[model samples]
Target: MDEDYDYFQELRDFLGGTFHQDISSPEQALDEYINEANKECLLFTIRYCDEFLTSNRTKQEKENYIQTNAEIYFPAIGLTPLIWLNNVVEQIKEAVKLK
Candidate 1:
């Protein structure tokens, strides 16, 4: 979907929150902070990607599903599930580089 929101700004905003109680809350620290519960939720959302690709639903229906699910699970991100998933992937990539 074509969205106008600033991607980096969302990351910045999330990192600014007090979600993590340990470690410095740097963007690079995202991977470390995503505990098991968050990981399970993210994985659950990600598993829908294949369904989104192959389903016979109309484009709008698929988009709506993604938005609804994202809002339910990750309202703080204020982004569609796919977008949030992409952001998570980017965070992982960055973390991997530090290893």
Candidate 2:
């Protein structure tokens, strides 16, 4: 995809497509739940990117870290954690390239 893709927009689109019915505002409870989950994933991605940039971890180690943490991050969001991580990593790489 485009190098300048917005991870949050991709995430929102993924959720909207996957859980279209559940995301409807009429389903207030479910909508709120999904929103919270989306927020958590976005927050986690930002923090992980910052941490990855500062850490001395090797690329493999960084991938492993994401793998290990996938369980915690994927439960509510429903997307496969590895896929989400890969997208986030790509975004981070692109950001670094522009810096």
Best by lDDT: 2
Q: Write the per-residue lDDT of candidate 2 for residues 1-99, one digit (tens) a residue.
A: 345755444544443443344333323433343445544454444554555545676666655555453323355555454455455556544444443
Cα lDDT tens digits, model 1, 1-99, are: 124544333333343331333534333354444432354433432334343435587766655654443323345546665565456556544444444
lDDT to native, each model: 0.44, 0.47
**lDDT value, candidate 1, whole model:** 0.44
Error of 1 at 53 (Å): 8.7
- Residue 2 lDDT, candidate 2, scale 0-100: 46
Q: Runs in model 1 with CA error above 4 Å?
A: 1-30, 33-72
